[model samples]
Target: MTGEVLWAPSAEGRQPHDRVVLVLDRGELRYRDQRKLQGIWVARGDDVGRIQGRQGPDALDIGAAELRDLLCRRRGELKPALMDQALVAGLGNLLVDEILWQARIDPRRAAASLTDAEHARLHRGLRRVLSVSVREGCVPQRPGWLTSVRARDDAACPRCGRSLERRQTGGRSSYACPHCQRPP
Candidate 1:
């Protein structure tokens, strides 16, 4: 996706430069805050396969079964496992936490060890969260959303009313409810 920022010139005011920020997950494109950036990532057959939701005939365009199969192939923790685009494309770190919390599945659980029912829950959660994100825009800032209460001093889980606990997962700070999302 392309992001264009409009700003007045230095002569007009002390405003930042107008620029286009192009961000590709995992693969770095240093436009937002970088001086120099270069990469040769062609969105061809092979590269399309690497990106999860690239509108190809791969995992992105497939149904829940394909998505489940893609995720189950990874043996890592759920957080990192979901974020790896090569495995299952569209989910980022925040989405990972959001999906896991919605599914009541612990982010620390092993991906390959999840029961069929748990997998079903995770899949349903993905559909619910992702579609809501697409429709409402920006991850849905409504009640029962972790992001809505994540930064508050008294952030609590919307589902169980328990305090939302912060923990490091895959080098990122993630918030979840311990009582709801017990480790599996």
Candidate 2:
């Protein structure tokens, strides 16, 4: 999650940040990690399933009905439930925050308490945000997106222009618009 797998024309273009380099006939596939937080695993056949079995379905492929069911079965706050790799895969902190912001749902809300409409909104937001994020290969800090202003000294909600609130949710720093996302 903290590194990039890039394809270079040749090994000559490898950067100082590249941790591993694989020279192929066509090009060089390099893994670059400045922080060294990423790992490479070699799996074959059934071993692949063994690794994936520990996690939930990929976030992008999960259906709305499945998401609702998953949430209904979860405990604690929505943020933590969503961040749980076993509950929903492929979603990290930034994605959960952005999805909650887009859906106008409070991150601190009880996971199983979401209304039908809220569930729909959450699914829609997940799809919309993830489609764009997957295309960009990362969460883009666009001006209109909450990620753009979350770390600002005087951040304002991109939607309501209200002051953004910061708090610890599920052991991670979370940003939300007080006006847009009310308490559970």
Worst 10 residues of 2 by lDDT: 33-42
Any runs in candidate 1 off by more than 4 Å, and if so which?
A: 1-60, 169-171
Error of model 1, residue 83, in angstroms: 0.5
TM-score of 2: 0.83
**lDDT values of the candidates?**
0.69, 0.89
Alpha-carbon deviation at 118 in model 2, angstroms: 0.5
Q: How would you encode candidate 1's per-residue C-alpha lDDT over 91-173 as one tens digit per residue? A: 66677788888899988888777888888898888888888876664576678788778878888898889898897744567
Tens-digit lDDT track for model 2 on 1-184? Answer: 3578898886677778888888899999998886554366779999999988889999999999999999999889899899899999999888999999999999889999999999999999999999999998888898789989998989999999989999875466789988899854
How high is the lDDT of residue 108 in model 1?
81
Consecutive 10-residue window with the lowest summed lDDT within model 1: 28-37
RMSD in angstroms between candidate 2 and the native structure over all alpha carbons:
2.9
Candidate 2 residue runs with Cα over 4 Å from true position = 7-30, 34-40, 168-171
